[model samples]
Structures are given as C-alpha cells and as structure tokens.
Target: MTTLLIRDGVIDDADQIAGVHVRSWQAAYRGLIDQEVLDGLSIPDRAEGWRRNLSDPLPTIIGILVAERDGEIVGWTSFGSGREEEGAGDGEVYGIYADPAEWSTGVGRALLDAAEQRILDAGHTRAYLWVLDGNERADAFYARQGWVADGASKVEERPGMSLREHRRVKHLAGS
Candidate 1:
C-alpha cells in the first residue's frame, strides 16, 4: 500500500477533484437515487461547479485535502463551517469522496482527521454532516468515527430532485 498524504488542494486539482466527485457519486449513489438523476450526472458540470465553489466566498469556509499516492492525486475531502441555518456551533463536512481503489486504506480517515483538526483550530468543538438515508457504508464509517445520528432528517437537493438524508454529528473535546 502506498502512503497517502493529505494536503490543501491547489487550483491544478480542479479536474482531479471533479473526477473523484463524479466517480464516487456514481458508485455510491447508484440504485439509491433516481435513475434520471444518475443519468444526468455530468463531469464537466461538476468540474465547473467545483471550480466556482473554490473560487467563490460564502458563509462556510471551504478547504480541500488531496490524498496523493506515487505523486498522483487519488482522492480528496472538502469541508467547512456549517451553514448559518444549521444552528450548529461546529464545522461541517460537505463533500468526501475517495477513489474506490483506496477504500479502507485510511485515506478517508486521514482526510476526516485533517478536517476535524481544521474545525478545532477554528475554535469549534463539534462537527456535523449529512449522509444519505440509504448510504449504509458512509453512515457506518461515520459511526465508527464516533459520530451519532441526531434524529434529524431533511431533503437534500440533487439533480432535478431531492433525496432524504440524516444529520450526523461528532463532539470534540479540547486538544
């Protein structure tokens, strides 16, 4: 197994991040989301969206962690403070996708750890994120990381539709 290093994303990572996002979405959401939504997935659109997102300013601060192996970017994680309406005094992880090839190899965990530290550094003591209702793998991963379901559910917008999801949170103590 190659050592996976997590680091801040550079502008050059736009395409890589987009590829991971599209591939992971297809793999992770297939059979769980509507077929139309799945069929309409566009890598170019997602790439442009990510490019704009990383360039734009908003309520949440966006950061990316790229997991590299043998000098090639394999996976990445993006996170930031929760939206103002989330009413949580903690950061929230929005997009997390790793190459399937790197699954269970600690890349995702390393990214989560780095994001957690960033949140803590921002003086936040907890973090939360939304996971699709039927994404057992992701939910399980969050559970293993000590995040608990908050008993809240909401509709998450997808392509031309909305999907159900659960809010999960993790409490962090002082370092």
Candidate 2:
C-alpha cells in the first residue's frame, strides 16, 4: 500500500469525491437500502452538489477532507457542527465514504482519524455520526475506533422505503 495522504478537500475534487460517494453507497448499502434508490444515483448530479458545497459551504460545515493514495482519491469525509436540536455532541461527522475497491485498506480509518482530530482542534470534546441501522461493517469499524451506539435511532424516508439509522458517539477529550 502506498502512502495515504489526507488533505483538505477542494472544489476540484468534486468529481472524484462524487464517484467515490456513489460507488461506496452502491456497494455498502446494497441490501440495506432500496435497490432503486442506489441504482438511480447519478455521479454527475452528486458532483455538482459537491462542487457547490466545497466552493461555498454553509457556516455549519467545518470541513471536507479527502484520502488519496498513489494520486487517486480513495475516500473522503465531511464534518461540521451538530445539526440536530438535541445532538449528543457539539461536532458531528456528516458523512464518510471510501471507494468500494478500497475498503479495509485503512482509507476510512485515516479519514476518520483526521476528522476526529479536526473536531478536537475545533474545541469539541465529543462527536457523533449516524450509521445505517444494519450496517454491521460500519458498526464494527466504529467500535474498533472506540465509538459506541447511543441508542438513538430514526427512520429516513426514501423513494420506495424507509431506512433506519442509529447514532454512534465518541468522546474526543484527551484523545
């Protein structure tokens, strides 16, 4: 494995990030989410959205980081202030995804570590993220990283189905 570089994401990374996002979702959420929804994901559309967000992020958005290996983007994460009215922490990891081909290659872990450090540097002592209820892979990964499910859950409405998600929290103090 080559060195994995974690860096702040720029607008130019939108296309690659979108590609990873869509591919990761298609692979990771296969049986957990509606097939139609996954099949309908458009890379171009996601790229445009990412482009806009990276270029002009909202105040709540703290940062976006990308993991690159051998000059290719293999994963990315976005983090920011908590969006929920009664969040478990002051900071939240909005999203994290690694290219399907790169799973277990430490890309996800690297990106996550960087996000956690960023949150800590921003003075947040704790942070949380939502994982699809049935995503055992993600659950195990987070567990290995010292995150625990906080028993909070919600149903998300999708095109043809309702998906459930659970919240996981990690204390960042003294880490």
Candidate 3:
C-alpha cells in the first residue's frame, strides 16, 4: 500500500529484477505451466540475461521499466517497437513480471499503465502483447484494462514442450 515507484531500468538493477522475474514465474505459473519447467528456471541465468538486456539494450527495445516498493525492485515490464509477428501496431509490451508477494498489490497494474504511456510517448499509436493462452488472471487483468484478444496465437517450445500464447491489442486515443 505504500507508494510504488516505476522507473527506467538500469544495469545495476539486473540482479533484483532477475530475482523478481524468476520467482514471479514460479508463483504465477505454478499451476498454469509445467511444474518441472517452472522449477528449472534459474535466477542466475535470468539475471545474466537481464544484465545483457539492460547493459546492452537492443535498438528496437525502447524501454525496460522496474517497479520498486520501499527501494526494492519487485516488478518490471519491457516495451518497444512491435514485433513483426503481430497485428499492425508500432509497440509491444514484451512482458511484465512481479514478485509473488507483490501480486494483487497494484504494482503490476501500475507498471502496465506506465508501459502503455511509454509506448504512446514513443509515437506508437497502438500496442500489443502476447500472453500465455491459459493464464486466466492475466487474461482477466488485461481485459479489465481494455485489451482484447485478437484471435492470434502461437505455439512456443519451452523445456521440451510446446506452449500456446495468444495476442492482445489496444488502440491509443491519439491513434
């Protein structure tokens, strides 16, 4: 319930961000995804990837933002130029992950609001995101925020299995 701060991510926050990323998936996807696969997620590996991402961001990755409560990173979301795989749009929220303890605390929602604004600030008129097909909590959250499923889907390989992901889109007012 304290003030939640959202800010641009920096390389120094990689470790904390990684911690949240892995733990969040473990919690959020516990029943939704394969237990073994979720258990296999490594914080160190995630941190290394985040370090590379924050340290040497790609040109298309416009922003990576983190959510902090009392000075600790508890959530993050990254958005950028839209992926070629989606409907005609100029932006995409690659992901938003939060520490399990922080779930339902409004941090994820706040992070999403910030990501959308950042997308619009970058001159994107529409934005889209891919969410795991069966993540009911996420699906409902996105729906409440006005995102609609666009009937697009993809199967991605993960830990020796295939997982289905669906797309959601929203049009910005200025579009």
Candidate 4:
C-alpha cells in the first residue's frame, strides 16, 4: 500500500466523507442494522449534513480527520468532548468509518491512531466510542487497539427500529 496520509478534513472533503460513511455503514452494519435502513442511506443528504457540520461544528467538536491513499479519501473520523453524562471528562470519538473496499488495509487503524493522539493532545486521559452491539469485526478491531467494552450500552432509536450500541473505552498511555 502507498503511504496513507491523515489530514484535517476540509469542507471540500464532505462529499467523499459522506460516500465513505454511507458505504461503510451499508457494509459494516449489514444484518446488525435493518437492511432497509442501510439501503435507504442517502449520500447527498449525508453530504449536506457533513457540509454543515464541517463548516460550523458544534461547540463540542474538536476536529475531523480524513485518511487519504494516493489522493483519494478512504476513511474519516470525528472526535471531541464526550457527550454522555457519565463521560464528562473524557474525549469521545463521535464516528469513524473506512470505505468498505479499504477495510483491513490499515485505513481504520491509522485514522484511530490519529484520533487518539489528538484526544491526548487535548489533555484527555480517557476516550470512548460506541459500536453497534453485534459488530464483531469492529469489536475485535477496537480490542486490538486497547479499547474495551466498559459494560455501558444504549439503545438508539432510528427511523423505524432501535439499535443497540455498547461503549468502548481506552485510557491514553501517558495519562
């Protein structure tokens, strides 16, 4: 694989990020989430949301990062202060996605490492992210990166279904 570059995501990257987001969800969440829901994902709608978020992020958003391979975006992540009441002092990885075709090619790992470093640089001792409950692949990936399922779980309401997600936490080494 060529050198993978991780950089701050720009407004222009919204469409590519949304493409990865939609494809990753369709591939990664297959069976775990309703097929109809995954199939219903709209890249245009997601791109618009990304455009809005990138241009004017919420106060809590620290940054967004994208992974590029040979000048094409293959993955992206967003992180900031934790949103849950129980995670007040912790950093949170809001979302991370790699193009389905890029899976297992180190894209996800690279993006995650960057996100962790940014969180640590922001003075966070701990960080967490949520993974859909039945995503064994993601569970294993996070486990390999030293994140553990901390027994925290929640059911999020989607369009016409509820999805269960479990929280995974990691403590930065230098903390």
Q: In lDDT terms, which candidate is top?
A: 4
Evaluate model 3: give its TM-score. Answer: 0.94
lDDT of 1 by residue, 23-130 (tens): 788888988887678777887887887787767735577577888888777788878888737646778888788887778888888888888888878877888888
Each model's TM-score, in the order given?
0.92, 0.96, 0.94, 0.97
Specify the poorest-scoring 10-residue window by lDDT in model 2. 81-90
TM-score of 1: 0.92
lDDT of each: 0.81, 0.92, 0.88, 0.94
Segments in model 1 whose C-alpha atoms lie over 4 Å from true places? 84-86
Clashing pairs in 2: none
Best by TM-score: 4
lDDT of 2 by residue, 13-54 (tens): 999999999999999999998788999999999999999999
Per-residue alpha-carbon lDDT of model 3 for 68-154, expressed as tens digits?
989999899998988765454578999999898988889888999999998999888888998987799899989988899998888
User: What's the number of clashes in each of the models?
Assistant: 0, 0, 0, 0
TM for candidate 2 is 0.96
In candidate 3, which residue ranges exceed 4 Å CA deviation? 85-89
Which of the predicted structures, 1 or 3, would earn the higher lDDT when compared with the native?
3
